[model samples]
Target chain A: MKRIALLLWLSLVLPLAAASDAHREYDAMETYEPHVRGDQSLSGSYKHWAHPGKLDWRLAGNPEENWKLNWKFMDPPFNASVHGGHFALDRGEQLFRELNAKARFARCLGAGKAGLKGLRARYPQYRADLKRIAGLEEVIEYCAAREGRVLQNGSYDNSAVSLYVASQSNGMPMRVDVGKGVMRDAFERGRKLFHTRAGKLHLACSSCHTHKVGLQLRGSVITTPYGDAVHYPVYRTRYFLQSLHLRFAECNLDTRTQPLVPGSRAYTDLEVFMTALSNGYPVTVPSERD
Target chain B: MRSISILAGLAVALVLPVWAQGLPRDAAVNAAAPNKTLEPRVVTNSGRLEWLPHAHNLTPWPTLSHEDRRPAPKPRKARLAGPLDGDAGRGRDIAVRPDKGYCIVCHQIPGEEWPGTVGLDLRGFKQRQYADAAVYQQIFDARVNNAQTVMPPFGTNNILSEQEIRDLVVFLQSLE
Candidate 1:
């Protein structure tokens, strides 16, 4: 009789404790609103109709104030909340900042300068609407669904969202600057990761995309990394809207290396480096691939 | 006898749930959610492979090969250890398999085209600083010998089995 009573009590108490703990881990002040059309690539609206003004906005101009957004990864608060320790957090922070920085830059470009030429050249067609639509929420959905597709040709099978994003800069040329500054360290690190063999295959980003640009991988023709970032989002017929950092994370996984979070610093740094590498190429999004 | 049989049955039932609970779970990878459509096929230089597995969070790779099923003691240094058994043909297949060991991605091997420049060309590996054990160590997990190595830990991470590593060693050795 005592044993049965104990088991009942234990199961009930343990589940309650676990549930509360999960509740606390999530951002208390934040909640996401899913897509209305019921698209899996978009976050799903739970229960009934949408809640107004509930978008969990990322890159609120800067990251210092938004550390708890779940997307502002590796900050001291986030590390402490999760007890992520030092080495792991340190590496994660680098990647997070890099990705966040690029997202910030892309947003900046999209808001007003998307279609301009030279350094500030963003696709003129893109405006605040593009950034408004390209939410990290969708990225979370994409990651959850595991919808990445790499064509037999080395280029990614991106989505219309990305293609729409990239096309905004169609008339401009890529002019990403790796000017001498604190950011140079990030650029260098990104370059190092590009060449370094990683992941299960022990292959670097340069293996297929750089050194073997024209080489065939299965049925896919390897494309150059140059000017690839300009297409901020690509509409891969198979994969759908692929953000720049998402593409980088997908590549990291392919090389068999554990990918940092999508908006992590490592990917951001990689983007900065890659964008700079393709400095002179024309920007196009939703680039057609086989 | 009837009471004892009842007790035995109760014990077996109790143990089964515990065993079922202990089964491996993929909580680490939440990307395994049911998809609306089946994933598409992706053919890469590494033969027929899928990108969906890569997208999903880290999961232990499916173990292949029954050869050399033994594992060396963990964290042991084998930089100078020479391998005992290896198959050159198998090694070559692994090297070229885009989904498997892409050794050709970095080094230039004899008779193999499409070599990369990131690592030393293995075309003349026989005449250099590479000892047989050194080659084995490097292939297994070059990090053991060099902490900063960009090379993957093939053996340590179970990316390649013990037999597969030995086969790679032999193929690399015969490159000259």
Candidate 2:
């Protein structure tokens, strides 16, 4: 009788204990781990992401000067031979720059979102149902991409332009003021766009990033959307100088959608919305990726 | 001894359904699908006009069309018939494996909370009019017809090996 009881306990109670222990581990992870990104708390700011001994973001050079700061974000972005052969060069220069090296810098969009009150007061009629319905045209013409002088080379003068602007906020937290009101509307648009599957693949941003955050494809991690925003101006060895907007355009291509011009109002809106979603994350600019 | 046997049997009965559903077959899947070869569109005499001014690995991947080019032919290499005798258990592992095909990302699978609605719902797949060959072909490479197909060329691009494709074929086809 004691042996039977022991068998029953072994079969049921022990397994139950293990399962509960696994749950406890998950719960502990939930409680202790500071969110790297995608924490979904709209009221939170990126300042809370300060984990004392994680990444040291105390550098003072642009991405062009200090590629060392983004050492962690580097994940070998290109097939050296393939990219080099295509560019008519020797197949070894991994740091080869494809976009314009003289690309300029602009203020971060999250800052613009934080200071949106002035714009709201300037154009009050753009408001609707407790939220600002600021159209893309108005946003584009008014701000000029956060005090950016439209460098001529047709919108996206190449990857260089994006590197310049995004490098300005390399060490800061990704802060977009989408707590409510106008920024919220933009965030909603980005959210909708993210969920809306498109093109030949019928893929939405949420399809990979949200639903399958840790899933892998082609030997690379399908990163979740939240923590992904701050690592802009990636020195994608495959594409050379890849900006966050250019990456969006590449994704548009991957999905078979007509890509919006980089630095366009559309991309800025999308960036603002994504940045707002990722409000409480650190900026890790000039990162490398495949 | 009798009580222990009964307890063990009960435990087996409880766990068997999940095990069966998750790993449908440990045995091999049949190679019933015929080879569907797609002709490459890059006829080289045109001064490589299809090539982008700069090769950023962006253009020339598939269809460069800006608009919806789905259901179009992919620019990847041709796929021969995949292997027979695939292990469905391994197939499930490959399907769920991260940083790879990520089939679960877009394709709704069992045991996932946020199964995507982008691709064909994997549920009720057995009821669909898919033949064994058709099932294998779609999963192996959906871009054969759709040049801009978002479904990766697992077979052609070598993302999933031929054996893995066969395994996925068996597992997916068995989804009733």
Candidate 3:
């Protein structure tokens, strides 16, 4: 009887002890201050030599203006509004509504169309029940699974629906909570991963994004990580719509490091860290990029 | 009963190896065994046999997904003891190749278009009058001077060979 009582007492107390230890680690962590400000433009003064012939000479003096012109020039053909119909946006909206109807996403999210305002800004959130950091994509995948449907993380359908839902919260600032629990741990891990140098090049994400921000690399300019996450699920001329994790994988490959699986815990943790840096920046889905 | 069973088990264990030695060794198994003396097998890709660099051929580096317990290289300063005798032209070729030195990725080299501005412009590097050994050390490991430098340790990390570093030094010294 005494042994049974001791086992129960140990089980109850052990978990509490472990929880406090995690909290202590969180308390000891140094606060991360983003290097780049929200207002600062990521575009640098470097001449866009990737396609010199395509550049408008009039906007040459102002790199920001030149970038805008270059971005507009690279807009996909589907972006055109034919006879008052915005094809890309309409398709995205249609797919989103269809998925919502099938999966009851409106009920699951505890919001209607109007109530979904600022919904996109609150993602890469820590779920107490799930006991892991869940990105917007992961949450959507979970909801879809409940309805007996599968939504692959980086697929076109996923991107389309995500872009549409994210567009709803367009102008709202990101508000990822990293104050307590597993979120704090994930944030710490993400920051470490970003700064840690690995691979054949011995390059950290900070090497290009933080240290070499505004510097040109061959034909392209390096952008700051701050305010960068806001415009993700961005439509690129090279590969239509791309998820943030997909882009992370591409960066991993560029550094000659084998990429972690998309939507994996490590990548989700990284997304949490990255999105937290853009805390004050407004979401800008359906954004185009060259 | 236990002693009789134990005796039988001991007898089987003692006879097992001896009984196996009487059998002929499989020729295929002997052929399949790894031999250090044998040349690396060429892989056939799209109907063409090529000596591509596989995981076995490449130098082991610390990768993101893998946990590397090896101690990281510390910043150190070392100089060549003799006069540099590397081919400047060959060095220039290596500097431009993306897979090799690719110095133009971060440094502005003369005659190179779309040069990156992350590192110092080497247009008049000859005028700096830096010692050849100093330049070699900087390329090998810039952390010896600046601990927070973003430049890759080309020599120390095995990204560039010592001869390649010597050639790069010669090429960098020739800039006027």
Candidate 4:
């Protein structure tokens, strides 16, 4: 009888202890910086630029120097402009207002644009009514469905609107509530997904992002996962206007794992896990990557 | 009555595919079907294309998912007792190729450009004087020596064959 009681006590206490350890690791990753070759001044700036001809001239000089120059030029732009128009952000805002007009998101979410402000920072939270964790994309899709519209996850319209909504919370620190309820479960699942090795290569996300940060994989440098969640719905040179789930799918393909459906429970949980890691970092959306 | 209903369901299930085959091939196959397999379409320079069915039917490893807490494969003993007779040239090729050993991704091998600095530099690896079998075992599974190693179990996981690991061993031994 005593052993049974002791076993029950251990089961209840062990998970709580493990949760605290996970939180400690999360705190460490939030501030951890991996060393990489680049000018520190050009880290997060968008205004720093060189003329196209001069940039080309420098790129032609040395092959090794070009790799460094690429990183210097690849910093996320503050306002990503493509073909003389902020197409993604503009389209996103238009869709957000349109969806709002049809669904009256202002009624439930908040009134006016002020309600939209800092909204992105609190997402991937447990929605008690829905009885599950909901990311911004999932919430948007749910609202869209009520208006007799189908907004597929990772679709262009979905990404664009998500980008706009996320842009509203720009400069606000991300604070995903992983303290209680289903959110804690989701957070734990996300952490496991991030560290678990899968697919043909048997490489976990941490194998490159954490263990081999700043190291070269083929031609590209492996980057740290810190502050990465800030820039979602980002435009990349190879893939224009991509959502975070799309990026996850791309990573899954790279590791030869079958990609999960976007906005699925697992992916949303992963978003929550990753976004929580960037707790103090300001949200930066619609950024460009190379 | 239940048996009759079950027989009717089975008959319909068997006939459905046959009926669908009368339609266009593309229309017959539901794109959203979960188990639908796709063929690799290879387009030639002349714009000619062919669908090579099952050409890319590579199955993912039967490894544990993120939720599973199962430990990875244990280290195995070395297959051979002595130095393997492998082509050093082929071993070098395997080490440098991105799809194969990709040793250059972490190890800074001699005369390799843009080698990563994650692992120790292997310029004077030959001077270490380790036996060829030891090197072979290390490449097969580094977890034997270091339980917490980030290195993948190439042999155990079937990422590399015995011969490929042997080639890698020869390549590493030749590094100077």
Candidate 5:
């Protein structure tokens, strides 16, 4: 009798415990909404469906007020009592602003009043520190590490985000400080790599895109690699979200070139190269494109 | 012997309800729900594979691979080329190649062969005033700007990791 009771009790209690653990984990993950929110790329409904608004909208930088959004009274599908409560929309926006202000490479030297024309003239140059090669994102990482007082979480780190925040300086000359040896090496390596061709397609990057661009081969136009940096974080029609590395990686795959992972050193180097190519172009994130 | 047999029979009857209770409520209500869908085909990049096993018929993928007698294909070398250098040739190749990274599928690159006009053109990209790195950063991940871009976050997409993107930058830079 005792053994039967114990076995039955164990089975029931074990299942209950498992259920609660699952629920708890879900709750914890929910707290990291900011990171995941970028993934949903929700349609228009996101503005209304997120957490409710709390009236505690403090003045900018009050410090004392608990950050939250202020939505008007509207009933949600879930709990009625919590209808008009707050979501952290304002808080998320605020953090983005704070991070943006301290971005690296905000005003790269040589960015004269003339804008991007002169800057685009010199590109695919080599860098020194990243002896292999470098690009805009790499420089951004270095700048963030050196000036923004932050860590370079690899290529797509938040520091990259901050660098993008500084892309407002479109139409300025590329002030790439090629003074450092490491910078020079990177610039040169970047140039050589740009010309090299390796893929089943047997075509170099310049073969089809630059020389034959605008001419119809299959059913597409070849595009010139200029003024691409000005519009980023662009809302594309096909993809679920704005993905810069995705485009870079996709291009490699298309070229039959070796594909590298998103956060790898090679990708970072390419990023720097492309940035230099579009030197003086102004940046426009949150851009919408078809 | 007779008494023991009677006791065994009683125990068998008593266990039926208990065993049934252990099943999920939905399962108990519809034990034949899985039978409704027959031969459902799941479409992936490799084409139509197989339908997911029923919940009641939980089976591992590796084991299923063996049972189906379909051997997986060998990995291709192009998928492993790594990353591109920042050059016009590389960027041009990227615009054309399909297996690595093709930007022309939905994007329009002016002066390229049959450039796609779905997305904005990349002609005169250098005209943007920001540093090359800033442009690279945008190419690295445009999600930081607008989240809803048909352009997959390639780095985030796992198709091409960060290093590959760096190589792509090299190819793109050479265009100028």
Candidate 6:
């Protein structure tokens, strides 16, 4: 009888003890940890992401001076040699830049002067023609299509343009209109999606991103969605591609929940919520990812 | 008396066939009659069983020994790696092994909360091209073909040893 009791006690105590240890380790990592990038063990300054207040706003104007872009984002794959040979920025990236500049300068749309800078701070607003709250990308797409310029898909170049243009507005206060009618309805819809629980895990977008912002998950910190929306067409190192909407769509699918379609109403609402969260935050387009 | 005499005649007549039905050998013979040796059977590729002449030769039925001499075809080479033999449950756990290195850190996977949306989903990979060596190469060294990829060669990274890579290869290959 005594042996049986002891066995039960040991079983209960061991798992509880292990569970506490795991929890403690995770809890302790909430603060920033010094990370090693390449050869140097960057002090808390270089590797650590600065708070929104510390970011320099001047670099947005100079196209050449954007240091945040990484070599991994710029380089071609090794296997591409099977093509003609290993190509350089002189081949693809340069053309990309030329097209980008031409698109901006053409201003074929009456959406007003190249006013993309900081325009992300005021998106998912009520558009008179659509009679619905539309995301910044949607408006851009509409303008592109109506003005007779070839509109890139909402999930594609719009995302890229959003990032680049929003970067110019970094540090600006988010100013999405929350007035009555279409604007209010869209905002509410976005809020509902943000807060609604779904998926096998029964988690909401706010569960991890909102409640746990800056909380450590493994080695990385949880970035808040508030200021994150300001950077569109984020150029991540993993795919070495530029498409913020692609990243956004991937996140929803990864949530283990039923994935919302890329250009669907749910994503547009989610975008509204995200952009509104960072309403006051300045844009940082084409930001580098680790 | 007339009715009784008629009934007695009928009863005697019914007993013989009823008694024959109880015989085991007769029953077995009746069961086997449908598959009797004398009847020719045709086996179609569609598996439709048809009773037809079995002999293909006009001169005489070919000997059983002649039919058995044909050689079998060689099996095709596997394109994708079969599932890894290491712990599948452990493989699932090892797949999420942050200590080993999180695949989701670079790759965007559905159902993981707040994962880095950097690479393609690793799910449904087996369906793309079910080859073991291809999977091994993908997990081992993606840079062998594409250096521009942000995916760190997990095996080459020294984060996961060769054995762990095999285990992960098994886990990823098991995904739908």
- C-alpha lDDT of all candidate models, in order: 0.44, 0.43, 0.62, 0.60, 0.38, 0.43
Candidate that beats the other on TM-score, 1 or 5, i.e. the better one = 1
Docking class of 2: incorrect
Decreasing TM-score order of the candidates: 4, 3, 1, 6, 2, 5
Candidate 3 docks at the CAPRI level of: incorrect
Locate the minimum summed-lDDT window of 10 residues in model 3 chain A.
A21-30
**lDDT tens digits, residue span A165-258, model 1:** 3344554556544555534555665666566444344456765654555443433345445434544544334543345655665565555444
lDDT of 3 by residue, B34-124 (tens): 4211111211111111121223211134433312222345565767868798999998998899888998988889899988889899899
What fnat does each of the candidate structures reach?
Answer: 0.04, 0.01, 0.22, 0.15, 0.03, 0.00
For A1-290, candidate 3 gives per-residue lDDT tens digits of 45544555555455445433421001122245432243144433223322323455556456545443323333223233232112344565776676677547755553555667788888887656466678877776676666666666665555665677787887677787777778778887888777767655667787777567667777776765665677667676565556787677667656654454457776787888888877875676566665
In candidate 5, stretches whose alpha carbon ends up further than 4 angstroms from where it belongs are A1-93, A97-164, A167-174, A177-180, A240-244, A288-290, B1-176
TM-score of each: 0.45, 0.41, 0.68, 0.69, 0.34, 0.42
Find the candidate with the highest TM-score and give its number.
4
Q: Model 1, which residues run further than 4 Å from truth?
A: A1-162, A165-168, A173-226, A235-242, A259-282, B1-28, B31-76, B79-83, B111-113, B124-130, B144-149
Best by lDDT: 3
Order of the predicted models by lDDT, top scorer first: 3, 4, 1, 2, 6, 5
Query: What tens-digit string does per-residue lDDT give for candidate 2 at B1-176?
Result: 77767777577757844542221121111123231111111111111111122212222122212221223223343444535688878877887776345677667777655654446667766678576676666766665566434465566545567777788877787777
Give me the displacement of residue A32 in model 4, in angstroms.
Answer: 9.2
lDDT of 5: 0.38
CAPRI verdict (incorrect, acceptable, medium, high) for model 1? incorrect
- Give a tens-digit lDDT track for model 4, residues B1-176: 55555555555555544432222232112244443323222221111222232312223332222222223355666666555878788888888887788888888877888887777678889999998877887788776786556676778767788888888778788877
Off by over 4 Å in 4: A1-85, A103-113, B1-59, B62-72, B81-83
Q: Write the per-residue lDDT of candidate 5 for residues B83-136, one digit (tens) a residue.
A: 344455555665566655677765556675556554556665555444555445
lDDT of 4 by residue, A57-104 (tens): 354355444443333333334233552114677877887787788547
Quote model 2's TM-score.
0.41
* Model 6 chain A lowest lDDT segment of ten: A23-32
Per-residue lDDT of model 2, residues A1-290, tens digit only? 66665666566555545433321000000111123433433212223233313433442123322222223424212112233112311211111122112321111211254332222112112334224433222233233433443322122222233333344444555555655765656555565556554433445566565554444443334544445555554556665544465567677755544344444444555666665544445454445565
